[model samples]
Target: MKESSATLRDLRPTQFAVGMIHVRRKMAETRAVCADSRYAFMEQRAIAVVRGPGGVLHVIDHHHWARAWIELGIERAPVQVKMDFRDLDDIDFLAAMMERGWVHPFNERGEKVDIGTLPPSIAQMPDDPYQSLAAFLRIARVFENPGEFNAKFAWADYLREHVSGDSGTIEGFAEMLATAFRFAHTPEARALPGYRPEAAR
Candidate 1:
C-alpha cells in the first residue's frame, strides 16, 4: 500500500518483448491523458514494481505506460512495490520470480533467452509488432482479453504464425488487424487464450 514516485529512468523491465507498445499510439494516448488535468487520478494508479537486490526497481507490469511516460518527457511517475525481493540473493530472487511467473525471458523472436539479457531500461526494449496486433485484436473484441500470464506473448506467437509483415502506419496495421480478426475465430486459434469457438461467434 506504500506508494511513491520513481523516475522513469530508474525502472527496469522484467520482459524482453516491447512489441505491445506501438510508440506512436501509446505516446499519443499518454499525451492526451497528461494534457488533461481532470485525469490526474491516473497518477494514483502507480506502476507495479518490486524491490530487487542492489535497490533495483524491477517493473512487474505497465511497461507500455512507463515507456510512454518517458516518451512524453515525464520525469517521474508513481509506483507501488508489489513485492520486495531485495532480501533474497540474486539467484534466489530470479528463481522465485520465474516460479511465480513474474518474469518473462523471451526476446523479440519469441525464443526464450537468458534473463540477464533483458533490457536494462524500458527504452532498450525491442518492438514486437505482433504484440501490438494482439492488444488491438483484444480491444476490438476479436477475442476476449487474454489473461495476464504472458498473454501478449501468447497472442503474438499465435499471430506470428498467421500474420506477416510489420507496419507502423494506421492503414497498414488496420489491414493486418483485419486478417488477424478473421484468423481469431478459426480452428487454428482455438488453443490461444480467450479464443472464441466458431459456433459461439
Candidate 2:
C-alpha cells in the first residue's frame, strides 16, 4: 500500500464517470510516445490511490491518466497510497473520504450517485459530455481552477441545466464550447467553484 506498482485493471475508480474526451486526449498523447518513453512518462505520474475498506484501492486523482493507461493496453502502472481508511466501516469510510474531498459520487448526467455503485474500473466510466465541456472551458482559459476538488465538475453541474447532447464531432464540441462560454460568465454561474467575473472581459 505504498509507492509501488499495481494492475491498471484492478484499481477501483472513486468516481462513477469522467470526461471521456479528456481521457481520450490523454490516450492519444500517450500513444504517441514510444514504449520506453511511455513507461517513463507513466512512471513520473504515478497514480495516487487511497486504500479503502477491505483494502480496496480507490484512485483519488489523475483519473484521465489512469484511464488512458488501461485503454492503451498497458498492464501495470505505478501507484501511491495517500491514505489508508481500511479500519473504518463503509459509512464512516465514505464520510472520511468526503471530508477530505477524495470521492466523486457523480455520474454521466451529473447526478449524485452512490459510491457503492460506481464502476469497478476507470475503463468502464461513462462519459459525461458536460464534464468534457467543463474541461474544454478550462483548456480554453475560460474557466480557471479555483484550487478546489472537482471544480470542473461543479461547473459541469451548472452547465447541465442549459446544455445537453453531444454531436461527437470537432465542430460539435466547438459549438458546445460556444454555448458554454455564454453561460460561463453569467451572474448565475458566478456561484460556481471556478467562477471568475473578470475573465468575462
How do all models score by TM-score? Answer: 0.88, 0.89
Whole-model lDDT for model 1 versus the true structure?
0.78
lDDT of 2 by residue, 1-201 (tens): 468888988899988887778888888888898876877788778999988899988899888899888888888998989899899998998899899888888878777877788999878988887878888788877667766566887888888898755548878877887889888888888877766667888
Worst 10 residues of 1 by lDDT: 33-42
How far is 5's C-alpha from truth in model 1 (Å)?
1.3
Q: List RMSD in Å for every model shown.
A: 2.4, 2.1
Q: Mind giving the per-residue lDDT tens digits that candidate 1 earns over 18-116?
A: 754465576776666635661364465578899999889999887877887777788888888888888899999998888878898888878899888
- Against the correct fold, how does model 2 do in TM-score? 0.89
Give lDDT: candidate 2, residue 82.
89
Candidate 2 error regions (>4 Å):
none
* lDDT value for model 2: 0.83
